[model samples]
Target: MHGKRVLLIVSGGIAAYKSLELIRLLTQAGCGVRCVLTEGGAQFVTPLSLQALSGEPVHTTLWSLTDESEMGHIALSRSADLVVVCPASADILARMAQGLASDIATTLLLATDTPVLVAPAMNVRMWQHAATRANMATLRDRGIHVVGPDDGIMACNEFGPGRLAEPPVILATIASLLAREPVPQDLAGRHALVTAGPTHEPIDPVRYIANRSSGRQGYAIAAALSARGAGVTLVSGPVSLPAPPGVALVPVETASDMLAACEAALPADIAVLAAAVGDWRVTHPGTAKLKKRPGQPAAPLSLTVNPDILASLSAPGPRRPALVIGFAAETEDLLANAADKRRRKGCDWIVANDVSLPGDGSPGVMGGDRNQVHLVTADGTEAWPSLDKREVADRLAARIAAHLAPHSLIRNSP
Candidate 1:
């Protein structure tokens, strides 16, 4: 684990002091450790002590002007190979589960797409509380690894299972995680531009037209690309999802905005147009809410075609990305339509998926975790099995790496 970096979050509780030992163990094992001390955690251990142990400055609040200028929270969140939350108190866990970014620790957790390992520590009762249980389940569902809150005597003297795991155990787990196969950085110096989520075309102040995209797939793609060491710029529409680590995020709402953002992030090596942009938008959105009146005719909604983001980005130009991939969400004739879309959009490839409801009543692909897709290219079509969105992202990212690998040599040639 030499040269591996770990972002250690020290939360509240008597167990917070143990994190200092954990830091020492991590550093001793040749891993660089950066500490983020929660306000509640600071009471038990001083920032000076943590800095001394980790051989790095400690982050306490989100308002560090120097830190922000040097390395912003987004950068700090992704700088580490893995993020460990030692002595993760109930409060911090709850805040993390609820997507709260009120503090530096929680904010980093929210912004990070890096693998996270959290060690919970609190009173036995708090650990067993319904809310805490739910929070742990949520975190686990989101793929956060947990070490232990082993049963033992606690600071409260009333315990069943709410003690932080020993430093050695945490260190061992960290080692095991670092020992896993490292991601291949084939796109080491490449840049990728990705668009995600549903573009909302407003009809009025409150009402809008949009798709059912949850942005999960696109976010996963961005994360996957970032994992391969590509500098990614994710142009996303409004969605209730956290930003992927190691990627710059440009948030927009309307299709026009998304198109503008995509253009601004040009000259990328790869462009994945995954957003379900609205085909048409309100020609003249109402200045006020279109009121409903009983026994009255509805308001006439005029629509106009929005910009074709895929074609625009795929246009032959010096700024055009080497590989342009577009998505075709079809309800029927998936492969045929996807191929046609690839030809029409002028993109190099099209990822086609069926968005129609399965007769079995299972959740559809638009807002779901799993997807079955077909890759349509000038050569032929390749069918992929039903897989988790992240798996698909990884596979797609690997293919992208393979596609760009040969060109990289030429680009780097003297």
Candidate 2:
């Protein structure tokens, strides 16, 4: 990163303030920073401020007579090792998706072939809007990298994702992308199956049982596996996250659906069951909404055990994956329970974490980005320090690669 050059595009939104910090981090890391500020972005932060931090002229217009005389936009676009869109507003994303060159920022984006990354920031509604979703999907399909719009409350007083990711997270992503080597082909001929999010067990048409899983970890794992040249199929439960690029997505609702999907994806080289599947479901769910009785105690509902997806996939059979991994999300006895679960479920490994709420009552790993997990295997347990979910995914994928290397396993085992 020391000699890297970054073209930073600042777009509108309250998150535009974060771009300043990002610039500082980039420069302090010895990277050359050049900024292109959109008109909407100027409303949140001034060009002078960006210039002060970048130690360079901030380009805010496409029609500068002196600047265009030297084809500045083209230079700026091609000069960087990477291009990052911080607080990528809905408007800019749409423009990029539609190939709109109406502004200098989009014009540069359109002209450059440099690797691009976007951190979206908008109202939660806008972020979830069908149009925005489509645009993001299109961008991802075109090979653009997306960091995050973390889940949280926003300046608009609305909650449930759309906040710009913290500067450190964005910076780490940038570092990962910039320092990345040629895509590793260690798992090129292999196939991977990954499960994510929380299963929704319906008690009625209007009510359901679920857990607080944002699906970030699972999605990151899928992305990591794909990056390592493995074909990935992600069987996802109900989650707000977008599908990772290069991974096939099979969305399901209940535990049974997820199990069916996983079985259908059989013969995989690896399987990582990261979904927080419900242990039980209503024995007999009501066909319609269950009405409340006037001033009476609530009706008791019966529950039955759901299918054990992990155990089913881990069964000893020719079609079983060479390596099956399960996740143990526990509140107590993290290692003890995780080790027992690995043995009982017959999985090759267990990734365990304590999802209990912190003493300060802040959000925990269930819905947060960072995690501290222990890798439990037949030999021993290795505790990993807290890290971003993507980092965790990279480390886990690397371990899988090592485990599957030639001579690591008996490929012909029954």
Best model per TM-score: 2
The local distance difference test score of each candidate is: 0.88, 0.89
Give the Cα error of residue 201 in candidate 1, in Å.
0.4
Q: After superposition, how far is residue 14 of candidate 2 from its true place, in Å?
A: 12
- Model 1's C-alpha root-mean-square deviation from the true structure amounts to 8.9
Estimate the lDDT of model 2: 0.89
Q: How displaced is residue 163 in candidate 2, in Å?
A: 15
For 154-212, candidate 2 gives per-residue lDDT tens digits of 99889987999999899998999999887677877788999999999999999999998
- How well is each residue in 25-141 modelled by candidate 1, as lDDT tens digits? 888889999999999999899999999999998999999998888657889899999999998999999999999999899998999989999999999889878788768755654
TM-scores for all predictions: 0.62, 0.73
